[model samples]
Target: MQNSNLNLARKWRSKNFDQIIGQDLVVRILKNSLYLNQFFPVYLFSGQRGCGKTSTARIFATALNCEKLAEFQKNPKTEFPCFQCASCIAMQNSKHPDFIEMDAASHTGVDNVRNIIEFSTLMPVLGKKKIYLIDEAHMLSKAAFNAFLKILEEPPISVIFILATTDVEKIIDTVRSRCFQLIFSALPNDSLVDHLSKICEKENIEFERDGLELIVNESEGSARDAINLMEQVRFSAEKITKSNVQKNLGHPDDEKILMLFAKLSQKVEISNLLGYLSEISFYELSATFIWGQILKLSRVAIYLKYGVIFRTNFDLEKISEIIKIVNVKHLINVMEIFCNYEQVFAKTSNKNILLETLFFKILDHSNKIEVKTSSLIKEPEKKSSETVPWATFLQKVEALNDPLVFSVFKRAKFINAESDKVIISFFKNYEFLLSILNDTRTVWSLILEEIFKTKNLETQIVEKEKVIEQPKADIEVEIHKAEPVLEPLKKNFKSFQNSKVDVSDKDKWKLANYLLESFPGDLIEVKE
Candidate 1:
């Protein structure tokens, strides 16, 4: 009796190389090998789960023994099996005597491997070649792999060995090095969507493009997972819309995700965001999933800011508006904060509080705000000699006979004076002295109180206004004016260098007199 409840993944399994999706390179290479009749003793197929590794192995094995392979190869076309043939029919019914399929996961013992080795020596009973396809080959025990190695390296000419594994690293290097390796990869998003659309059309199922896109994204490039998810959605709802998929899958809709991000960009209050979030059930959704969506949106928003739009469901205008309010820098800051706290969401038991706190943190970073400079580079207070107090404080500090305190105060310009505080500005060159003065302020507070007659005194130090650069034209004018003065000195110095002068003690007086006559400056000392 035919089973009525075969799942889509199994029902739609690829039987030929041409039927496979998202693995064109693997298909081409296999076809070329079959056309040339170049068969390797052992073949290794490796990739992530649901990536058609096992299916490709089956098709390759079937094609090698296809009765009409010579006819298919004569035309330079793919050597897909002629299903009408008796051999192909046996393969389709899973009753092929020469085709042996084993699951290494269940049969990992050395005894199980002995059976495979025993079968390797036998000739084909139904087809032209004997084939053994082992799935999850990495699950085999060390003894089993070792026992299978010699035969794997040197199998019978009529037999072929094919190993399919999700993790090729687990397979010993000796086993790997002896086989021709073919890597199966996850299908691309576009290819998966096309495949889904074709299946939906053939199955008479109703689906929206966006709905199919959600399934494809959730599958993360696995065709089997995608088809299974589509089947689940189809059974749960009459029509495959985005809402129905979200309802059945418990995934948050793109609209809600966009709305939440818009509110965050608007700098909404934490209470408002939390209240809005209350509508969605956290039990149905994982924090990591929501965070991943936000991260994707942030990346899209940043790209949209520069007029680059990727394949996404969010409206372009909406993203444009958000990017306008939140510049790239702000978006980058939010992404960085999200990444920094990503692991915390998975580790924390109370996701609600952590999620709320994360929302608050994102809100804080979403908007651009001016922050004050560091204490070392504070804005200088306005200068007003009339408003300042303690004019004789410098004199008092000088009287203390402490040169350190006196020097710090001497460079300060009085800016303001309050009842119990004094404000002073320091030149940029003297900014280094502020730290020294601040460190000693407590030690001299008593002295400051006596000088100002205040119970307690507070000193605030700030950097003075930066000096404006002299204009280029004015600088050129000053240079020109000084050139006349420098010209005479240059000529006199050159003459002194060229002249030969005796340097005896008595003749030293002549050089000194010569310098005095040549230059306008007076000679204060005569060094011998």
Candidate 2:
């Protein structure tokens, strides 16, 4: 017995080439091949799931084995199977002996390939040709593919292998090259809507056009998903409505999403929004959906700004208002922030808190911009006679032509500035910078004096003392004994060598001779 809940997808499954919807091109090509009596030993069908790959394979098989096809071949006009024939009925019921279907997902081993190879050697018991339909062929193991490659290259005269996969990139190049490739595309929204409407009328089911549109939008171009969604909605209520569709699909409320966007644009307080958000469950999903809507509207606004009249279902006046308030760069920033944190939000256990934090961060950024703009408008006028402060002088230094001098000067603090002198100090860690600035003080003082309209402007550095503690008495005695005994003679030799020497006054001439021998070149000038 079959399940009482009838599957509309299976009940209305396409049985022949002419009956398949949204795939006229594939049907025409197959019909042309049938008319010419030319067929490939292997056929590869690649497409998204439920786009009629397997169904087309079965229809092609039926045409190949149909007893009525020979009669039609003589007529040269009909290219499809007569479904009333015994072979057609058997194929439709999936009871034909020669029509073998293998799901490579479950049977993804060399053993399965071996069984297939073994089966290909025999004659068809019922049909004219032994047809092998391997679905999800990409899931086959490399070893299994290697085992199947040889037989696929040269199958028996009466055998045809049809491979179908959603991911053709996963199939090895060797296997892909040996077959006739046919690509199926996702059904367009219009085609899907028309198909769903026909199904509803045939099944005597009640439906609204907008309700079906919602289903199409959620289907993302997959026909199977659209039908399944329609079936779910059909059984949930007496008549399908947009509200019921949203409820069954767990889609965010459209009105609430729009209201939130409105509040965001109007600069509503974050606390108020949080109160509203707390009342709604699935805030994370709602936020994600709102982000998508904003991104879409942003794109439309950009196109409109560029004078491109893009067709959209959104309210034009509302979009115009949004464009007036939000610039493209800000929209891009919003998108980037949301996208970067999307994965974090998905992995986080405290999604509500994370969502609240995200909203507040965006709000804070907006408020900061508003405050900065207001401050700029309210700034007081400056007097030309007054001298610039040290902070303003630093800004002028930053704009100097010589970056090296300015780089050193920017790190020092201005201690005092008088008519003829300017004093600067450096922290202990920045003493090296102070030393470098002091070495170039003459040039910098001239530049500063010219800028300040004062003569003899002397820039000074104030260095802090670095104290060193003395060693203990015992360690000092060891240090004194370790020095050379002839201190006066070592000092005289040190003066001659121009190098430091410590001694306790003993045999300094020997040390001087050793230094001279070690550095003989030091006695003469060497030119490159």
Candidate 3:
């Protein structure tokens, strides 16, 4: 979108009431107000930069001052200058005597504002109505604003004042109370894209639809920003494409970050991950892009364990080993690290320091094990069938509505209740179980004692953790419900293909309730 020689955003800029984009409602309201002669002076049009606040105000002034719609439409020359007329040309060029435009930003002093008020005593030189268009009017000094307030409250019938600002809150309450307020919102993407495409076509600038989509996405719903970005890109290149937008935006070289994330996820060595991350200069990456890449990779790893689709941009060779080495929860923790760092990166100027700190944090925590009990990070073995005190303890613990703790634990299967009071095991896989218990000690105790009914309970997380040494489909310390419960577990647990728990009423009730509370589920039960 490189139009360096001239501003394309201005080339296709809106003119006339009919030309505005993505603000139909606001336009309609203003038009109706004008047509109905419901003139409320002291208007405030507020929103972000480049949303056309000044343009709309100027045009509204033109329409208001125009002598005749019928005669102007026919011959088209009045004091208001119908754009086709000399008067209109002067107005467009900001030379019109009756149409006074002021910048409160620069003339914010009391004297500058007092001058406008002093001049208001004189009537318009020519036009039927004199319109004062104030841009960024919020910059007016408090004394200046107070001076203008007297005039604004009971100005001569000929004067129409329009105050424009991006910050409505800055305008004093007295000024606001006298004016009609129009809130201009950021343009929507679909609307922004359609307008961009039409403008590009009309201007003869070549733009790819996908590339246009990227620009629109980058604009974040600001129509002006979309056009500005378009101009910047179109100015430098002959044609605007997705890659071009990606290059200038520094939007995280998505493919590269995805590749690195995929590699780290696959158990790529800490040193190697660091080396790869270092190759992509920190400045080349944006916090948002990093966050998105890390989150996606972590989600994919979690999805893989759950038998859900792990859609990824990276090659299989890059991620397969990491997924084998690191469990889902730890991967999730790593993602959180990046997401937090992204926020920090966005706000601070000390980017290199912040990024380096974040890199080390991730690298350090990369070895974080989910198991709470031991140093070894190994998967678990199937548990023994023999009924253990801890088995009863788990049932009581699982029954509580300790929401957040239960929310995470619900992801685990009821692998086996340990025989000893000192330690508990779950997650059928030894490595996975160990990772949880080791990494989350406080949660481990709270989850076991508060939920499991064993306050003295300690945890031991084992690696390559042992198998559930039990007979197939055996039940331990089952809690029969007071009322018959529906079989939600049988109905919806295809992800737990390796699960050996019975789908009986109580089991179903417990699973269903947990699912309902932990995951947003559509599960229903008919106890009757």
Candidate 4:
């Protein structure tokens, strides 16, 4: 019998292959191998945590050592272990002597590995085979792995080793090559929800579907996390409500998030939005969680616009409202902007200010896109003469004698053409190029005037404004003050006095020549 006081995640762990969820293909392959008795001696199970790697390893061990496995094999009625058997019961209770388990995270040294190697040398005390399950095997030290390698390569006839890890890349390639590798994937949301529902029913706990959905979303496809969250919510409140779920998870209410989306779509004032945001608890409104909700809504809107059927679990009316406000292109842009800012928001010390700024940016972008799109729809077409082919102009400039000027123009962007001027912009980093072009602006103006068959066409260069970040207060920057050194002139004066005062000396000759040229006098005596 299982302990009633055990946590939901522990009590509801899959005991057999059939009970495992969200890995049908892996389960099928493992079952076929077990039924045919063609299992390998060394197996590697790797994937995200709580995705059934350890559970499946334990189940496989139980099946391999079960006394009734032969009976079940002969009957063909059951493929899993007979839980009533001594070996199966012992494995379930984690008391089986032959079924040894090791946490490589704690025992990562060579001595710990040597103990396992020594144990593998002994025969099974009770079961037909002695099974070793090493969890977080990637944490094992290099020497420990080397110590276990020989035994793993050539273990006893009755020994089986199962190594499980979340990070397979960290494990040594040699060890990975020796074992038959199996990968487990995260459980899907629907599958996780159904599993959680079943557990809730079994535990006689009442839950709202929306509350379970919130839990599933928060779990990020981990079954163990979902069940643990459910257990937390269960103990926190008499019944699992959506509000209670959000409160427990430190997340804002779904309705408020949706309202925020609605306000963004409607282009709410930043001040108003900030005021509303201030009314809510900042601790509850995690920037990551808010971004996730926004991304979710954007994805749903995009899917709906593209005629893709997507279920967002929100009201259909609300979904339609948001879709009507923003097109697929707009939603994609929103997602991209938030995606880029995710790291910034995560690392920011003042999240509330950053969140408000993010909202303002989105609203500003939405307004600009909307206005531009509307103007494009309403504005009439212009004459060809009004539009300048900037590329052709650049090509002509390249063909000219001045390659330096052409290179500068290559980095310049054509802003617009006016009746009297052709405006072009350059990045702030290329301000020197702009300056050089501006010095020769008349040449460009004349060239443009000739090309366009118009006079008085001035060429204007503008530098784009760049945002510079303010230095952080916490950063300790040491500014070195340069001090001028005044060395004594006595050594230099002595060297000058010791020099020969003849005409061969360049200094003496220059001085004498200057005296003769300036004074028109001959020197009778020279003083050293």
Q: For residue 510, what is the lDDT in candidate 1?
A: 45
Which pairs, if any, clash in model 4?
none
lDDT for every model? 0.80, 0.75, 0.69, 0.79
lDDT by residue (tens digit), candidate 3, 53-83:
8888878887776656445444433332257
Model 3 RMSD vs true structure: 20.0
User: Is candidate 1 or 3 superior in TM-score?
Assistant: 1
Per-residue CA lDDT of model 4 for 1-528, tens digit only, reads 557978888899898888999989888788777667787889999999889999998988898888877776667567568888888888878899999999999999999988888878899987999999999999999999888888888889999999999999999999998899999999999999999999999999999988899889888889999999999999999888889998898887767888888777667677777777777765456777777788888787777777787877666567777668665666776787787778888898987678777678877843433332432144775546544566667767877866556777888766677666666666766655555565567656666776654444334445666666546663456789999999877754432234334444544465465445545655554335
lDDT of 2 by residue, 473-522 (tens): 42323234565556454443332324444442435443344345444533
Residue 368 accuracy (lDDT) in model 4: 39
Name the regions of candidate 2 deviating beyond 4 angstroms.
1-5, 68-79, 265-267, 282-294, 297-317, 345-353, 366-528
lDDT ranking from best candidate downward: 1, 4, 2, 3
Against the hidden true structure, what lDDT does model 3 obtain?
0.69
Which of 1 and 4 is ahead in TM-score?
1
- Which lDDT tens digits does candidate 1 get at residues 1-528? 143467788888998988999889998899989888998999999998899998999898888888888987797654468788888888888899999999999999999999888877888998889999999999999999999889988899998999999999999988999999999888899999999999999899999998998889889989999999899999999988888888877778777888888877666787888788887765457666678878888898888888886877667787787668776777787788778777887799977678767778878744444475644354987646643345566666777766666777777776665676656677676766666576667656666677665545344546567767766654433233444344344443322223344434534464354344445454443333
lDDT of 3 at 113: 82
Model 1: pairs clashing at backbone N, Cα or C within 3 Å: none
